[model samples]
Each structure stands twice: as structure tokens, then as C-alpha cells.
Target: MTERPEPTFDPRALVRSLPQSPGVYRMIDASGTVIYVGKARNLRRRVGSYFTRQAHNAKTQAMLAQVADVQVALTHTEAEALILENNLIKELRPRFNVLLRDDKSYPYIYLSSHQRFPRLAFHRGSRKGPGRYFGPFPSASAVRETLNHLQKVFPVRQCRDSFFENRSRPCLQYQIERCTAPCVGYISEADYARDVRHVEMFLDGDSNRVIDELVERMEAAAAALKFEEAAGLRDRIAALRRIQERQYVAGARGDVDVIACVVRESMACVQVFVIRNGTNLGNRTYFPKAPPETNSDEILYAFIAGHYLGGNAPPELIVSDDMTDREVLEEALGGDAGHRVRIRSRVRGERRRWLELAMSNAEHALSARMSTQASMDRRFEDLQERLELEAMPERMECFDISHTQGEATVASCVVFNREGPLKSDYRRFNIEGIEAGDDYAAMRQALERRYLRVKKGEAPVPDLLLIDGGRGQLAQAEAVLGELQLTDELTIAAISKGPRRRPGEEVLHIAGREDEYRLPPDAPGLHLLQQIRDEAHRFAITGHRGRRGRRRQRSSLEEIPGLGPKRRQALLKQFGGLQGVQRAGVEDLARVHGINRALAERIYETLNG
Candidate 1:
């Protein structure tokens, strides 16, 4: 291969400007959009490597050739550089980098500590407040399912302290035996405190002990002729047993974290399984980036030091391998956690079994990623052959519109580069100018908004653009691109449903082509188009539904004057919906918190008068 030219920018000038320290560097276009991001030990040599002829791969050559500017942020050390790189790539989203697009925050189960009667809740995003958060669980439903099981196993309150205190009678949590209802005197403060202690024990990994105590209480209650309470306790105990059975039992290891690392083609994926008292609570995966030449030991060392720089800590961490400065790392982690951190290698026994489980998960994850990549490459090749393009449409973008009788119209733009779905690049638009039910106008609006960004150099102009419609939709999109003088800058096509809304039969339109083309029902190229079109449609529909849901939330009197969060919550507690609030009397309104006499009268007059 011919050597690519060095970037026209001054190398010495760049190095002189950069600190002889650790940090992340970005190669940017004249417009200041980051094309690639990297971390460096010797800021001079690492960056100089990019400008050298022999150092450039076809990909890096293309990336560097476009570099008109360089941006750098100095860090304290190489480990900090690694972390700063990951965070910047996540935020700036450079083009010529292998990115992890599904950056959605994981769900967690939180037992609120701020309230007198703390509730077990499903939470996501920041854990910036007072709570005992027990997970970075895989999904919201996963946390909810665990919360449901926890409620059954432990008779602790799941209502706010205010709601708990104001209750004249036991609520459904008490009726369902999930709560002791201390607010209504059904359970005493001391007894509720004991229940809270048991809950803490359960969360701390002493599930059997918690259940044993509950079982004993139930037996005693039955012996005292409290049959109803005893039966409820029996159900709870049974549920706890069921939950315990579901957990994977590892012999005699208490509250340990098993971590395994898998590195492939310079990308490292770390798998973590949280085990509490020998039972596997849950597992999560982290794909951390580092220097291309870095080894597993070096990567893990950085991962531990940088990952937990501000993150939560587990007392015992079981790893597949040991670190060089295990003592220093443990101490650093301990300082952050305010508890001694134990770092152990996977040895033969229960610890080894836990490590094996984590490795197995890492293997499965890598296998899935490889499969997705292979499928994507194959689909791209097939598209290239069909479209007769200069190259494979390595970066394909699909557009679709969604509406509910035109009431809540929305459009979605989804990107799939060489790897697979670039989820982070996926965007949603609220269709502003189109009339309800006008799909063509909606398509036009979406394309204009998308291409205008391209025109302004705000987004990468995709190699191909797939529209989810027929010739008419294709015409509107074509017109927009023409007006923007980018008609040939992007390859455009449309996929439309066939006669009678059939599954396989479909019509396709290409720019400047008068006749619609038909492909074999199972043609690979056609199937690829269908897949892209379907994904765009799914994305659009999901966005539309979310917007409609939020709109429904806003239209209620909950948004009316003087109805704050506390009062709105109280109204929801009494009345299920807006109609219920409307029908509620002045006295009922006054019963809600923060409503008071005047506010209640204002609400009553607004509704009834």
C-alpha cells in the first residue's frame, strides 16, 4: 500500500503545546469536530506515530489525512488518561473510533434511607442521594422483579413516611402482607425496626437468616391463634424460599465480586458477577478501552484504579488474575470505600467456580459481538453488490416516521455503520410542520432536518440513506437533498410495503430512477433493506409512544397552577386519574398534602365552579 502523507499541521508546534503528561488527544477537522480520540503516555511520541507514513493503517491514514486541528486534555497519569479517553469518546463521539453505542445507564434496586418508613424502589441513573442501592442490574424490569420478591420476603414498608404516618387504615401493602403498616398501629415501631434489621441482613447476603427469623415469627403467631397473620407470614416465607432457590449457590463464599477480563483485537471487555453469601445476585459487563499494546495486567490495573476513582466499592473482589501493586490498589480502593478492599486471584474451589462463571459470560458476550459483526459485514457486501456502489455502504442510515392518527407524530433517524447499530447516533424528531396523518410531509421534514445537519458539517453524511416508504416518499427526500446541494453526496433509496400489505413483496425506489424495482422475495439485498427499514420503523414508533405518554402526563390539571409535586402525588394517591381529581370534593382535595384550605378551595372552584 502507498504511504499516506503526514498531516499538514505542524508536529513540533502540537507537541510543544501539549504537556509532557498523560491525557486524551483528539484529531479534528477544520470545523473542530473530533475525528478520532486517543490516549498517550509520552504525548509527543504517541501523537507523532499518527503523522508517520509507516504508522498509518488504511483507516488511520484516512482519519489523520482529515485532521486540521488537535485537542488535548492533560491528566495526572496514564490510568487517568485511559478513563478520560473512554469518557470523552462517550461524550464527543468521534467518527474514526470503535465505540460502544448502547450507553444506557443500568437499573438498580434502592432501599430509601431518607424516610422513616423506607421504601424499596427500582432506580436508574445517578445514585446521588441517600439510599442503599444494591445493583447496576441488567434492566429496569430485573430490578422491579427483585423489588417485588424482596417485598414478599421482607415485611417492610414500601410507602413514603408521610403516606405511612397519615394513614388512618392499613393500605394495600399491609393487606398484601408486604408491609407491617406501622403508620396505622397494625405494627409497632419496635417491631417495624426489627423488620428493617432483617431487611438489612437480607440485602447484606444473609437471606437464610432473615427467612428463618420470619418463619419462627409465623410459627409463634400461629401458636398464639393469630391465624390470618400466620398464613400471610407462611406465604411470605414460601416466597423467600422460592427466591433463594433461584439464586446460583457457590459454596460458602460471602458477599464476593467475581471479575473476569476478555481482550480481543485491542478491545477489552470486563465481566463482573456480584455474589452475596455464595448466591449470585447479578452480573454486568464493562468494555473498557486502553492502549493497543497494553496487556491484561496493565488494563486491569488501570480499570481498578480509574473505574472506582469515584465509584462504589465491594469489600471483597475476586479477579481472574492478580495485579502488580495489589496492596496499593487495595489501599486506594479502601480509602474510597471506607472499608478494606480484598483483591484475590481465582484459585481452585468456590472462588474458581465463580471466576469460571464470569469467564463463561465473557465468552458468550464476545461470541455474540462477533456474530453481529459478521452479519453486518455480510449484509453490507450484499448491499454493495445490489446498489453497485463505489464501496460497501459501510455507514448506512435509515429514516422512518410514526404517528397515532397524526396526534403524536414523530420521526426517527437510526444509523448502522460497519459494526452494527450505532445506537448512540440514533435520533428522534417531533414532526413539527406536517399535518396529522401526512406521511410524505413527515418524511420530508425528517430528511431536511437530518441533511441540514450534514450541510452544516454537524453530522457525518452517511454512505447510504434508507427511507421507509415508496416512490412518493423517495421524491420528497430527494427534493430536500437537492435543495441542500447534497443530492449526490449521499446514496438514497426507499423501501415500501407491497400489494395488500404483504410480508415479502415490496417496492424499492432509487434517486433518478423512474421505474420501481422488484427483487426476489428472499433476496439477501432486499432482506437487508427490509431489516434496516423495520428497525427505523420500530425506533420511530417507540419515540412516538414515549412522546404521547409524556403529552398525556402534561395535559392533566396536575400541570395546573399551584399543583406542586407533593399535592399532585397526594391527588394521585386518592384519585387514580384526572377525572377522579375532578370528581373529588373540596374536603377530599383539602386532605391532600400542601393543598391546605385555600388551595383546596381554589382547586374545587376551578373544577366544580
Candidate 2:
């Protein structure tokens, strides 16, 4: 067989043959990797400029030297070319492109449409489900905050479909007046439907209409001699008025997004504030990965194209910086949204104020991010010097165990790296088949499970392993590593509280050393150790509490004699939950439909005991 001849590239020859049409271009190096992606209205002129231009930046000059092949995909229009460029950039992630690291979808407030009493909830993924979505809110917490406020004012049901279907009585939400207990027929269908309509109107930015209708209902109830009903309606109206006052922008209506970008020392921060129906739905900060020396306008342009093209672009965008491609972006975004979109840079009054606020936030966020990075670098250096390691530890894992009286024990492992806490690598193990209150056994089991995976090459092995107890816990970790034949690969240390059990008075015990090492109260290395150990403790306690709560919520009621699922559910519904049941006397328990005096007494005794 004969080998093919090596292919050679000539930029001038390629540019000569290129057509003068709108298209996307990819510059590939000799190794067959795309190093840059771009779009142009006149492909021939744009491609020729790279070879003809005399004044090029260092980055561009370097890119030009390595460009062995240039490819182009023709499009019908500049807008089409812009979209194709974004798609290709996201798919290929060329080294020279301004990449947007936004992988998570925005959150929305979903209102179910099929149910008789529709439910409101937080949604974050695909919108193919049968519901009316009210937002592409910046974050899940913002969606939840809006939902909570809506419930307080509208008394609409927000429970899951399963919970609503099985309800036999009013739940705690109804008692707290946040819901009307539509599941149990506490509110008539007509009245519930009215409330749902009001919720819809409020979310649609028609709060004035909702308040007006509510005032009419209040007057009607008063005229009908229903004083209690009138009072409730009056209170709902007041809450709605208060919320409207707080949320509505002074001179803004409809949907708009305020976007600001700040670039300093090759780092950039972008802040986006969402406004729907004139209400501020909160803001989120994004730090997109871009090549060095990229300006704010370029980053803002890339962000708008990559972000809004996914289909949730508002009608108007108030940007902090002016971009040369503003018209092209507006056209592309408008096409995606099926409406006209506008990008405004020079504004006055309220919109200008919003832009300034977004700019300020971006500056602050970038400063904090840079500070955190500098601090992390300093601490990592100090830790390396203190531990006498051969090099800086790139990854460290800390293990801590938590339990209450040996029940529902949980072992948590928190990982940290040079950048900071690596939350994605954090793990929690539910320890089993161990003697109660045996921290050593719990630690041993957790390490065995975790390292078994590391041995199989399933996870990265950390350079350091920090245990959260004294010599005993450290011994368990050492034994486990020895069994796995990984003792020589990583360092081991344990942190234990000093004699007085205080923050700055902790002793660190290294595996191969006889005497414990103690650092000064203000040592950076000690501060780093304390941060990781405290995080492990927090994670462990959180897991332990959740496991304990779920176990008790189900087991405590099931253990009682003559208390089947029906009786237990009935008691829970009447009293609201397990804590309410625990607080109720035997007489109060017997008042439930299925519980008799004898069974009630038995339940009280079992729960109280």
C-alpha cells in the first residue's frame, strides 16, 4: 500500500478562491484541531484581511502562524451566519473563542393546567409538559421566592399531585392560611377557580386588575353579612397591595433584561437582572471563559448570542456596553423569539439606573472572585510549606462522621483543590452493620467504600486525607489505606480539638510523626484546615439529620398497634405532621375519625416514650 502525500496550506490561495458571501469560518491548525471560529458578512474580504493586514495583536499573530487550513460554511444572511457561528462555537469549543460556560437551564414558575385545582411549582428543565411557565428566572431560589409570596397572597395550592390526591383533611398549609385546602373541599370549586385566576393575573403583571377584583369581592362579602369572609378578603387584598408596591419598578412595564459586563486584568463578570411584568425576579452572575485581552463589548456580544438564542429572550435588552453587532444580534434574537427585540445601550431614567446597578454588581463580583483566587493561592502555599510536602497538594479529602445516639449515622467526605472546595466530588455514605456509637467502625466502612472505587480508577486519588478525630479515627483510616495498598500514595493526618475544645486550639497528628503539630492561632495553613474540617462536619450533620427525620416520620407511627396506614395518615392530616402528633394529648388524638380512646392512649405512650 502507498501512503498519501502530506497536505499543504497556503492562506493567499485559499482567500483567492473564497466567495464574498455571509458565512461562518473555522481556522484549523496542522494537527487538525479548530483553533478559532468566526463569522463574516463578506467571506472573501474578511479571510483575505488576515493575510493582508499588517498590524495584528500578539494572539492573532500566533494564531495566524499555526493556521494550516481554513473552512467556511455559507449562509443566506448575516443573522443566519451569526446563529451558525454560535452553534459551532458551543459544539466545538475552539481554544480561541469566547466560550460561555453556562450549562444549567434557567428556572421558571410552572402552573399546572390540567388539574381541577392547579398547582404552582418551581421548574428548571424542558417545557414540553402541559403547564404555563411564568419565567426563565435567573435562579431556582428566585422562582421559589416568587412562588412563596404568591401562595401567601393568593391562597393557591402548591402541593404535589400525589400529596393532593391522597389528602383526607387539611394540611399545615391550610392551617397557616397559605392554602385553601382544595384537596379536602374546604373551599368551593368556584371560589378556588377565582383565586387561581387572580394568581394568573398577578403573575402576568396585571396586579392592578387582581386587586380591583379582590376589592369587589370584599365589598360583596360585607354586603352579604359575612364578616369573617370579608375580613379574610380584606387581608388578602392588603398583602397583594404590599407585594405590588415592593416588586413593581417605578417606570417599567412588560418584560426586559438588564445585562452588564465588566472586564479587568483578563477576567470578566456578567450580571443579568430579569424583569417580568415590571417585577424584579432577581439577578445572577456569570463568569464566562474567554481568551486573554477580550473586551467587555466582545464578551457581552458573545453572551447575548449564546444565551438568548436558546429561546427566552425578552422583548427589550438594556446593556451596559455598546457593541458593533447590536443590530445583527437583535435581528437574530427577534427571529428566535418570534417577536421584535431591541438592544439599548444609551438610556435615561429608570432603565439607566438599572444598568448602573448591574454594572456595579458586576464590578463587585469580579473583585470578590479575584480576591478569593488570590487567597486560595496563598493558603495552598502555606499548607505545602507547613506539611513539608514534596510539592503543593493538588487535591485533599476530609472525612467526618455524624450521628445522634448512634442512630442514622452518616459519614461525609468533602474534597478541596487549589481553586477552592470541589463540591462536585463531595460524597456521603450511610454506614451499616456496625456497632452503635463506633466512630472507628464508621470511619473504616466509609474509607473502604470510597477507596475501593479509587482503586478501580473510578475517582481521582487525593494527595492528602484528613480525618476529623484523634488517634483512633486516624488508625481506622491508616488501616483501610494499608489494606488497599495505597498507603504510599497519599499523606494522612487527623485534627482533634485541644484540651479546652476551642477553634484556634486544635492539634494535628500526622501518621508518621510521633509528636502532634500545632500552628499559631493566625496561621493560614491552620485556617485552611479548619475550613475543610468544618465543611465536612456540616455536610455530615446535614445528611444525618435528613436520614433521621425521614426514618422517624415513617417508623414512629407504624410501630403502634392497631395503627394502620389509614389511621396513621388520618392522625397526620388532622394534626398536620409528626411533631403535631407528638404534641397532642390522648383526648386530642381520639378526636380524629379513626383513632379510639384506647388506640390514642397507646399512640401517645409510644410517641412520648
lDDT, candidates in the order shown: 0.73, 0.87
Q: Write one digit per residue (lDDT tens) for candidate 2, span 1-609.
A: 999988689788999999999999999998999999999999999989999999987768888898999999999999999999999999999988899864557777889967788988767679999979888888655665677678778888776777789889886567667788899899899988888888888888888989889889899999999999899889988988888777878888889999999999988899999998899888988888788888899999999999999788999999998999789899999999999999999999999999999999999989987887668757876887887765467689999999999999999999998778999999999999999999999999999999877754457778789999999999999988865545655789999999999999999998888988888888888899999999999999999999999887779789888999999889889989888999999999999998899999999999898
Task: Name the lDDT value of residue 321 in candidate 1.
Answer: 72
Which candidate's lDDT is highest? 2
RMSD, one per candidate, in order? 21.3, 16.9
- Model 2 residue 530 CA deviation (Å) reads 11
* Per-prediction TM-score to the true structure, in the order listed: 0.50, 0.65
Please, what are the lDDT tens digits per residue for candidate 1 over residues 1-609?
A: 999986677865876666677677888897778888877776877786676547555666677678898888888866567667767766776766644433345557778765566666656678889978876564443554566567656667655455556778876556545667777777666776677777777767777887788889899999999999899789878877887788757484666777888777776777878766666667766666444544667667656655554455578888877777577567667766778888888477877877998888987776666666556656776777766665456578999988889978999999987677889999998988667899988888888788776644457668788888877888898888865545544678888888887867888788887777777776677777887788898999999998898678545556468887777777877888666888898888888767787888777777666
Q: Total backbone clashes of model 2?
A: 0
Off by over 4 Å in 2: 1-5, 223-225, 373-533, 536-609
- State, as a TM-score between 0 and 1, how close model 1 is to the true structure: 0.50
Model 1 stretches with alpha carbons more than 4 Å out: 1-7, 12-19, 48-65, 79-83, 96-98, 101-106, 113-116, 125-132, 136-138, 160-171, 215-238, 248-271, 276-278, 285-309, 313-347, 365-609
Candidate 2 lowest-lDDT run of ten: 481-490
